[model samples]
Target: MAVFTVVNETDLAQWMRHYDLGEVVDFRGISSGIENSNYFLTTTRGAFVLTIFEKLTAEQLPFYLDLMRHLASHSVPVPDPVPRDDGALFGILHGKPATIVTKLDGKAELAPGPEHCGEVGQMLARLHLAGRDFKSHQPNLRSLAWWKETVPRIVPFVDGAQRELIVGELAHQEAFFESADYAALPGGPCHCDLFRDNVLFAPAAPGTNHQVRLGGFFDFYFAGCDKWLFDVAVTANDWCVDLATGRFDGARLTALLRAYQTVRPFTPEENRHWRDMLRAGAYRFWVSRLYDYYLPRAAAMLQPHDPTHFERILRERVMHADASPLCN
Candidate 1:
């Protein structure tokens, strides 16, 4: 999270009174992401995360805050938003919608092994199934519609070949989404941004061979209604591949799908359209990185990620996909 708005301790401590939580003990800006202004806050009661909405307005926040509440209600491991005495999930702080959620206990498994990937897959399936009955309906903000609109904005910054690839891939994904197979895909509220850093894993007991255990998922601001397959694809494209080479790691990929299938069986159409979904997932991030890289918002500790990383990933997924029973 970036540091877009600075919150003085006096102002923050004053804001803390609305909830039953005690005096603010520690507050520090989180510097790992580009989306929102986030801080790790500790009170006499417990540790929590403070987030100030950067792009989303107060009106647009209920969807995410409520989604997490719903997921927690369904026994999913999510950080439920802390409500104010007035029973609101958010309050205005520094003139932006601000929220606090209980901090999950663990660190992200950035270099996840097959077991970690399996855990993620199972958890993601649970998350998707848990949101099946959520009341709100917000379209995925960065869906195909967004890609179509965003590509033009970033086109002027790329080379001719990169431009052609972006245009061609968009058209490909557009046609794919319009096809009958896409209609067959299941839709639900999805944790569309389940990258490694968003998940947490705690260390196991000293003697055990197992080093870590899944804690919970957070950062639900990117949550949206989208194809479940797209969610799976988004996660696989990150947790099941080599970061340096952009190649699919077969063992991790297989482990991930095997666990995911145990929770929710995939339809034959999903298997047939798996490759296309993977490509679309890659395209989504590639477009986003380009947007952030070329046209960025001002925020402290915000560094635009390299757009070419996902472009390389898109090329690899296009060229070298593995065959598995999940896709058969």
Candidate 2:
């Protein structure tokens, strides 16, 4: 979590009063995100996630809240923002946008097995199906034009080999998608960042079907219009495993794709583009990490993550291009 802001009890109480959530009994800052200041608030009412918007503008608050409500209404497992007695989804707290949401129960599935992958795949398919009818029309953040702008900013940060590979990969992806065959691929809203951390899973119970159940989806900051296949590719990159070297895992890929295809079968064109999309997804993260690497970071933070983690994943993806590990 971005630790730049100093949230205090007074700020919490004032924010809660705006929503008429009774007096705040206690609150603790949650340091688990990179873009916002989150606090777990305990009041007479119950526990809730109090988010003070740090990076997003006030104008964008409606879109984020409404999108969460929309997805939740569609049976998507996401944190629905609690409306205040005034019917406001957000309130001002310490000169920053703040909202309270019901805290979802579950832990981050860091090392998801095949069962977890299957559930995630099914949920993504459902998200795509549900999102097709969502009326909102937010601009795509990772569109081709955006990539062109972002790549240049990150080019200087990458090593020689990575820079060369990324440059060639970008051109290849651009040209491949420009073909007529790709013109008709289905387009819809997608959860652009479905990383493992963003997905929460409930634990299995004894004597019951011990399967990884969907918990809640957070971080909609990147949700926007995009290719349905791109979402699939992102999921593959997040869940797939490579067993031989244990460097990459494709088992989750098999489970996820198989489960997803059972619900929404990929067309031949989408099938052909899956590998390319996976490669592109890896590169996308690589670029993002590189950008973060070069950018200035706030000093007050817990366990700063290395941007090169994604870079390593990108290299592994490029090296295994011929393996087509997920095809099995």
TM-score of each: 0.92, 0.88
Please state every model's RMSD to the true fold in angstroms.
2.3, 2.9
- Superposition error at 197 for model 2 (Å): 1.0
Give residue 83's error in model 2 in angstroms.
1.9
Off by over 4 Å in 2: 1-3, 20-26, 205-207, 242-248, 297-312, 315-328
In the range 149-251, model 2's lDDT, one tens digit per residue, is 8888878877897788768878977896798756867878888889888988877666778566678778877888788888887777777745233255556
Best by TM-score: 1
Count clashes in each candidate, considering only residues at least 3 apart in sequence or on different chains. Answer: 1, 8
Model 2 vs. true fold: TM: 0.88
> Which segments of model 1 are wrong by more than 4 Å?
205-211, 298-301, 321-328
Screening candidate 1 with a backbone cut-off below 3 angstroms (N, C-alpha, C), the clashing residue pairs are 1-33
lDDT of each: 0.87, 0.75
lDDT of 2 at 182: 69
After TM-score superposition, the amount by which residue 208's alpha carbon in candidate 2 deviates from its true location, in angstroms, is 3.4
Please report how far candidate 1 places residue 90 from its true position, in Å: 0.5
